[model samples]
Every structure is written in C-alpha cells, then in structure tokens.
Target: MTEPVRRRGRPPRAQQDAGPGMRERILDVAREEFAERGYDKASVRGIAKAAGVDPALVHHYFGTKEQVFAASIEMVLAPALEAPAALVDGPLDGAGERMTRFFFGVWDAPATRAPLLAIVRSALNNEVAAGVFRGLVASQLLARIAQRLDLPEGEAELRASLAAAQLVGTAMLRYVIKVEPLASADLEWVIARIAPVVQVHLTGP
Candidate 1:
C-alpha cells in the first residue's frame, strides 16, 4: 500500500484545540497586544499567535483590525456605554448629574477599573491608540449624548465635546495621574462637585 499523504494546509494543534470561548480569548489577547504594541504596531497574526489560533480565525470573528479595536474598547467601556440609556428618558436638566454619576460609578467599581485604566494609559502614551480611543469617544459616547440632548447639530457637538473634556480631564487626574485629594477623595463627594460642572457644560447657556 502507498504511504498516506499529509494534509498540505492544516492549522496547528493549538488552533484546532480552541474552545467555545475562543472569541473572548481573542479579545483578551488583543487587549494586551494593543496595550503593549499600540494600534499601529499590533497585528492580526500576532494577536492570533498569542491567542493560540490562526490569523484566519481572528479575521473570521472581528473582520478587521479596526473592528477588533472597537470590540476591545466595547469590552473595556461597556458600563459607561450603557450608562447613556439612563439619559434617554430623563429630564434634560438632570442629564449631567445622571451622566456624571454613571461614569463615576463605573470608575469606582473595582472590577471595571483595571481595563479602563489600561486603555487610558495606553491612549495617553500612544498616538495611534489615542486616535482610536478618541474616535470611539467622539462617535460613540459624545455623539450618543448629543443625540439625546436634542440640540442643534453644531450646538450639540460643542456641548458634548465640552462635557467629554470635563469627564476625561477628571478621569485623568483622579485615576491615571492619581492626583492628590481628588484621587483619594470619597466617590460621592467627587460626583457632587463634578456633576454640576458637567451639567453646566451639557445644558447651560
């Protein structure tokens, strides 16, 4: 009998063994890769190699590098992203307070802070990562808030951008920089002081 021929193109054993959570595993590895390598340097092949799967599988799940970045952002910012739903039906006057509280709540939660901090740190130091992050915030977070505000196009964008500046600044000081007083202060106290600023930015003339 003739010897059997081996397959010409087969995945490595690692790829064949990926389990039900392969998508999540990809995201986890992608997060580290993006954090370490920034957006421009991180590659699908590298992420797949770290994730123990084929590059084809990464593409199969995420479609593109940008999509993978968006998914990683969504995973890190899920709480804040969902917080906007609370604004959908609430009084416009209180939107700022609600938004402020929601953000602080997410930041205050021990479970969510690590990934959030990692993203913020990476964005601060990496221009490519910063662009990806800034786009996500502008299109997803600020744009959503602007829509709910029902202001004119120009005014809404301005208001949302201002409010975002306040929140992002606060996060940078309190979490990333670990500034004195603000970093160690009580969560409710910080919310009280910052919410009004955010509220004015959102609704004040």
Candidate 2:
C-alpha cells in the first residue's frame, strides 16, 4: 500500500481542520511571525504552520501575504480606530481629554501594547510595512476622526493629522523609545498635559 503524500511544509492532518475564529487565529500567528521574522522573511507557510492550518488557509482568509500583514495591522490598531466614538460620545468641551485618555488607555494595557510594539517596529524597519501602516492610519483612523472634527474640507484632515501626530509622538517617546522622565511619569499626568493640546488641534480656531 502506498503512503499518503504529505505536501511539503504542510501541517499535520489533525491540524488541518479550521475551527471557529480560525481567521483571527491565523492573524494572531501572522503578527508573531511578522514580528519575529519581519516582513521580508515571514511567509504564508510559516504563518499557517504556526496557526495549525494549511498554507492555503492563510491565503484563503487574507488573499496574500501582504494582505495578511495589512489585516494584522488593522488588528493592532483596532482600539485607536474607534476614537471617533470618543469624539462624538460627549460634548466637544472635553474631546481632547477624552481622545488623549482613550489613546493611552489602548497603549497602557499590555494585551494590545505588545502587538502594537511589534507593528511599530516592523513599520520602522520596512517600507512595505510602513506603507501599509501609513495607509491604514490615514484612511481608517485619521480620516474617520477628521470627519468627526466638523472642520472645513482640507483643514479637518490637517487638524486630525496634527492631533494624531501629537498622540503618536507622545506614545513613541513614552512607550517605544522609553525616554526618561516621560516614560516614568504617571499616565494621568501625561494625559492631563496632552489632552488640552489635542483639544486645541481638534477645536481651536
């Protein structure tokens, strides 16, 4: 009797079944793969193996490796993507504080921060990853928040981008670079100072 032909780089038969949340499962593994191996080295087969499914499954869910990487980017930025809600949730009087607080809230939590750090590292290291990160930040997160700002056509985007820059720069200094004073400072203390600036960006004439 002939033995079953095992395709090269495929996971075991027992691992072939894609159960519930398989797409998310694949993405989680893809993040780790990209985080560790980087964009150039990470492959569909490797992600699938780590995900306990076939390589075809990763392609099935995300289309291509780049697409998978984009999806992973979206996953890490999901919380920040929801910032528009914070804008609309209450009076514009407190929008800056609300937005600033919300931004750090996402970063302060360990669950989201780890993947975020991986993504930021990848973005800084690879142009492809950086492009994907930039596109998503502009289109999905910034554009949405800009619309909520209720400013004139071009100005809204400017305000949104500036506010985002402030938030992102602070995060980079505090979390990524671990710069002294800022890194060790209290979260509320940081937010107290930043929220006003964000409010100005969004609402000041």
- On lDDT, the candidate that comes out on top is 2
Query: What are the Cα lDDT values of the candidates?
Result: 0.82, 0.86
Write one digit per residue (lDDT tens) for candidate 1, span 11-100.
445655677798899999998888778677889899999987788788777878878887898888876776686664589889888888
Poorly placed runs, candidate 1 (over 4 Å): 1-20, 35-45, 63-66
User: Candidate 2, clashing residue pairs?
Assistant: none
Question: Candidate 1, after superposition: displacement of residue 162 in Å?
Answer: 0.6
Per-residue lDDT for 195 in model 1? 92
Candidate 2: tens digits of C-alpha lDDT, residues 1-205? 9979877655456555656688888998999999888888899989988977778777767887879999998988876786666665688778788888888988999999988988888888889889999999998878877777676889999998999999999999999999999999999999999999998998998
Error of 2 at 154 (Å): 0.4
Question: Candidate 1 at residue 112, lDDT?
Answer: 80
- Model 2: what TM-score? 0.87
TM-scores of the models, in the given order? 0.82, 0.87
Q: How far is candidate 2 from the true structure (C-alpha RMSD, Å)?
A: 3.0
Give the top-scoring candidate (TM-score): 2
